[model samples]
Target: MEDFALEHINDSRRTILITAQLADSWNDRIKEIAPDFTIELRPWAKAADIPDELWENVEILFTLGAFPTPEQAPNLRWVQLYSAGANQAFTGPLAKSNAIITTASGVHAVNIAEYVLTTMLTWFHRYHQFGSWKQEGHWPDEHGRDLFMPEELRGKTLNVVGYGSIGREVARLAKSFGMRIIAMEQRPDHRDRGFLFPDIGDPEGKLPDHYYTKDQFQQALAESDVVVAAVPLTPDTRGMFDATAFHAMKESALFINIARGDVCKEPDLIKALKEKEIAGAALDVFADEPLPDSSPFFGLPNVIMSPHISGMTPHYNDRVAMIFTENLRRYLKGEPLYNTVNKERGY
Candidate 1:
């Protein structure tokens, strides 16, 4: 097989579809990399809104949110997603399609990891308690100290479930606080997975004191002060944190879910919190978006919730562009793309 590369593009201009409106500067950047390619901009308002003819000849696609089937785009060869977690897009009929799929996996690691550390610090320092005191216009300095003593992250065991890009970033930050790390991953033996992003995550697999596989989930849960959920939402991970899983954790352990909400069953989490099975929880993503007004999580004093925006960053689009542009070059040459998804595993 002649390995694909830029030379294979030939003189004919190839069609590339971008489903989002980008600055004109990006056009120049793409041209600089592959001058023979022609770009088509189509902001993804609705998938069905796109004309049938537009999908007929698109060879490559850059999309933030939209999945067209192989039948819809006969000429489509590759898809570079603007978001992390392929989820529904990677599964279903598309999984069997000829088109290759890639995700923006490591792009959110830096921001999401920072959010995790911020929540941890806030919990440790009892910042929420201080806010309450301020609201009540009461200041009992010594009484406050006695009521809510501050704890240090140092020397604490931080367990990171799903040691992928996000988990690795959490471990990297946790290490800076002098915390001991124990992470669980699907493949513990293949510890060093390369990433496209720079200055993020534990590439060397040196941060965690030990790494465990699925069989040791209970053991990992039992030996930590803080447990961070960074796994994707897959069949195996759905409702993974059930009653039995909650019972395996230390009573004083703090739980943080930066991963999908379905990973932890809502009922099990509620029961654990109400019964004090664990100390506290900080959640970024949930089973349902815009968590309903009637949800009990809103009233939990020990819980902190964000509207699934932990990964938001000003440079998000720029980073996505970089990943897509790099992969586009690889695609032209017929080389392996970065962040290529494993549809079977659902990462």
Candidate 2:
């Protein structure tokens, strides 16, 4: 680790190369914060067209879109991705490289967690159906018993998959709502690492009474009343929650996904909902962006869908910018970056 830190500092004329499409304000902001660092904006150049001269001294690559192959930038050391998910970042040649990759993992945790809770509450209270009732002025036609909705979250179990920063935040908020929380994280020694949440008695502890390892993921899914997918997309996680996994869940369980849509197969989810294998689902991301109008999810009564806006809060850009700026400082000081993604895990 110390040798890695030294390598970054020893590099000459540390250039942080960024893609063209990023906002001018973002470029100006980076320059403002790290005036000594050479911030290069390379636009209109294909990955192969990246000038060999630019690669000579470039130490860090602040990537927004698909990264150039490592062979294209032989001297590249660190990659700071704009997106929280590092699936695309770890592919083919890039995956085989030794570059350190970090993501904006925790940047959207609070906002996305809030979105999950809001969607869950909406489903629990039947807000959309109630709105339809009011619009039709049909409330008086139904008896009180017929119109009453069943269940609340007070004692229900919320199983959070992939106990990263976002998962921890979701667990903390769920616990505050008097809901039982179960978390599944990747680390074998997660309890001792204190990364997602502190130990049970630690002041920073955010975990609930029960936590599960990768080996126990199936058990967690079986007992959950609400299953929240907060896991990152990786080779191992692609289509992780397929038809068989859905069948393992309780018939009345509500599923919420704030993670990548590709993590769950679209056809499998549609089939599960249509066959009543699961109670309902709220999805904020899709395998395809701007979910096609022909998609079956749009017409499903038991499905709640959004246009991948779970992480888009009022201050989203500001929050992302802050994280990037702080990371720039770390990059300059030869310090370890935050939210570093494991290349092998691809998250």
Candidate 3:
């Protein structure tokens, strides 16, 4: 595809490139909103498969990970990323460009929030130990048996770091379980600016009992029984949870991270777990994916680790298409787009 590069191919018209999987299903929707656009539904697994010549007129791009540099697609006006997090797009070659970037932000909010709640309850109920008993077909004796422990979700404080769509949904559900909310935000505001599913999240931001900024993070950490880190992966957030941060939390606080792994320092977290710096944890994302077989998190008894699947759902593309189609409609009307990444804030 590199060999197909052109010195100059000018086109004063907008073009849309749909390289994401299930492109065929969304083509009509794209055409509906962008009838004037030169639509190209070329489903590709890698950027190299896309010919360079196609970039000349490409103003809109929708893809999973595939991307062309500024030079390759200089006419690019808007980029619709398949994933909710715009971290990769902001950090990649397009970082310097003026192209408008939007994300599938609200798509995974519901599923990820549910996953966080599941992990929290799993730890609270100690069901993992019961799994061992069921596997051996053995019943626990009365000495350690208390099936109805009455340990329910009530009056517990949940500190949510980075109050975005996922955090908002989590706050909404945790509230339903009678948990008080404490939010620690980067800018410390209740107003949600991203794409939202109707009636699904804390849209008005009235859920939080108290809102804390990053400067007061340690204090917020100490007050919570559970901490959910759902902040986007950015320069300010990467490795933000180090030894000092973990130590600031109450020793009994349950750490739940459905956000990017790099947000927490892996080795420090392992040490904290081993030393009982915190009660336990449920980690979906990780600093290293496939979580390296040699990683200490795998051996830690108190840690609930998954292969970074908290955001997955059967309706992923369906929801993504909602945000994309709506954005397309707005684009046609020259209205402000949804979930546009903040160049300064880096989300």
Candidate 4:
């Protein structure tokens, strides 16, 4: 269910502060949605650039990074984040605010889920290893011809480590490829809870053949031919996938992480890769972005590393705007908002 725990606050003349590069069309759309409310589109470089007088009148704020001090925007009660992850939203001044925070959780779900499938297929066929053959201008003879044989995705089991919006989409795509889906969910969800993209994800949560809780974490890991980590980074989730979790997987299993880097222990993962504890890993998010030059992940032949960008697409901002507009309608009607962030849960 959507979060309705937040109480409604009303003002005769409300002001919405937006500090992102929004389109003229979107601004006009917001104006059309809330005709009486004063909307300010100040895509400023810093909070100081925004007039203090304007800050005092702000009731709602939409941003990716910009946040106001408690004293700066006393009237600010709602925050609409521009990204799927709520981790960054929980940091800085906004974390302490009583604002009813919402995220663009379903916006990036489609793109990130596609990234998961791409990596899975790439690893399964050992496509990256073919680069050496290409550079050498040599084709493997009959004896080594098996190296070029493609691995079929049919009938393979996929373990969705965290079954949120992104994982749901991943399962939907993998299902079409005839793969079995198992999900490790934090809660008992027979149906999807919040912010589903229009007919895109596993809305009924029926894709996964089996659902396991945190208590069955190791069992969940062992049941996969391919494991996709789509979990959020919370206090309970940080460093959750260490040696034991890796050890639980089948030796030939492929591990894929589109989630936050800290979710896996870097050294343990490297050790697992070195020992062939699991066949390989496809990592998008890293504990440290740009993945330092000294990092061992670069040298590991079995690891596929990308610069933490699994959730990007040309239409990204447009989808995020959709979520914001929907929430705005709900805000005006004093209804529950989608993708509402729970501070205690740290999603």
lDDT of 3: 0.84
Best by TM-score: 4
**Model 4 vs. true fold: TM:** 0.96
Write model 4 residue lDDT over 117-188, tens digit each, in one string. 899888888797798788889878899988878788989999998888999999999999999999987676
Clashes of each: 2, 0, 0, 0
Q: Which predicted model would earn the best lDDT?
A: 4
Worst window of 10 by summed lDDT in candidate 2: 194-203
Query: Which stretches in model 2 have alpha-carbon errors above 4 Å?
Result: 1-3, 6-12, 20-35, 41-52, 134-137, 188-205
List, residue by residue over 177-238, the lDDT tens digit for candidate 3.
99999997654457777787788888778999999988898888888899999998999999
lDDT scores for all predictions? Answer: 0.81, 0.75, 0.84, 0.86
lDDT of 1 at 176: 97
User: What's the lDDT of the predicted structure labeled candidate 1?
Assistant: 0.81
Worst 10-residue lDDT window, candidate 1: 1-10
In angstroms, the error of model 4 at 114 is 0.8
Model 1 misplaced stretches (Cα beyond 4 Å) = 1-13, 91-96, 188-194
